[model samples]
Target: TEHEVQRWPLEPQGSTSFGLSRDGRFALLYSEEHHLVLWDLEQNKKLATLGELDADGNAVSHIRISDNGRFAVTAGQMNFAVWDLGWTQAQGLWSISDALIRDIDITSNGEQVLLGLSNGKAIYVNLVTGRRLEFLAHREKVNSVAISPNGRFALTGGNDYKAYLWDTESGQLLRTF
Candidate 1:
C-alpha cells in the first residue's frame, strides 16, 4: 500500500526543533526565531503558538509533546516551560539553578514531567501537587529521560554509559542497564 504524502508549510520559516504527540494528532514546532507553534495534524490547522523568551530573550532548544496531546514542554539551557494545550496557556515556567536540562518527558496525563540534567540527575515534578523527587543514579550527564504512561516509573540514560529505571514517586532504583 502506498500512502499519500502531504507537505504542510509552516510560518516563521526556519524551525530548529520539532515534536509530535504519541497519537500522531498534534505537532509542536520550534523555529529558528524562537516561535513555538502547535498544529492539529488531524484537522490540518494551527492550534496555538506557546512559550515566552527568558530573561536573556532566548527561547528553548528542545521540545516534547505529551502522549495524550494535552501538554507540551520546551527546554532551553537552564530553564523549561510547560504549556497546557487545551487551555493554550502556560502551566509553569521553571529554571534549574545548578544543572542544565538535557532532556525532558511528560506523562500522558500531563500532570508530571521528568527532566534529565547535566549533573547526572533526573528530577520528577508533579505539576498538580508541586512535589519534586530526584533520581540520583547516574554519574555523568543525563542524556535522556522518559516517564511511563501511568507515571509510576521513569527511565533515564546518561553519558556514564548506563541506564536506570526508577520509581517516580519514591525515587527508588528499580533496575540498571
Candidate 2:
C-alpha cells in the first residue's frame, strides 16, 4: 500500500479562520488583515477575493461555504453578507441592530440563510421570497448554527448550555438537548 500527500503553498499572511467546501474542491481563507480569498484546491490556484470591511468597518470573524460550494456567508459583530459563489458576487448584506450575529449558514442552492445571534434567537431568511422567521429557543447567546440541506430545519447551540432543533418555516421547537 502507498500513501499520497499533497501540499499547496499559501501566502505568508496570518490566517484567522477558514472554511472548506463539502466536496473538498474549494477553500475560503480569512487573514488577519481582514482579507478573504477563495482558492481552487484541486487546481492549486486563487479563484477570487471576497468582501470589503463589514458594515462596522471591522474584520469579518466568521465564514461558511455552503455544502454544494455555490454559496457563502461571512459575518462581523452585528452584520453578515451572503455571496453567490457561482457569480462571484455578493447577493445581499444585512445588519442587525438589536443583536450580534454569532454564526451563520446558507442553504445549498444559495437561497436560505440561518443566523444565530447573541440575543438568544436564530433567524431564518429566504432570499428569493424575502421571508424572515425567528426562532427563540435559547436563553443566552447562540454560539453555533446549522441548517438542513433542504432548508427545512435548524439546529442551534447557545451559551445557556442547551441545543435546540427547530422548524425553519414555522419556528416550532422540534427537539431540545
The clash count of every prediction, one per candidate, is 0, 0
Residue-level lDDT of model 2, residues 17-136, one tens digit each, is: 677899989988777564778889999988888756364566777889998888898888887788887788888888778688888999998889999998998899998898999888
In candidate 2, where is summed lDDT lowest over 10 consecutive residues?
Answer: 51-60
Model 2 segments more than 4 A misplaced = 1-6, 32-34, 53-56
lDDT against true structure, model 2: 0.85
Query: What C-alpha RMSD separates each model from the true structure?
Result: 2.3, 2.5
TM-score of each: 0.89, 0.90
Q: For model 1, which pairs clash?
A: none
CA lDDT, every prediction?
0.84, 0.85
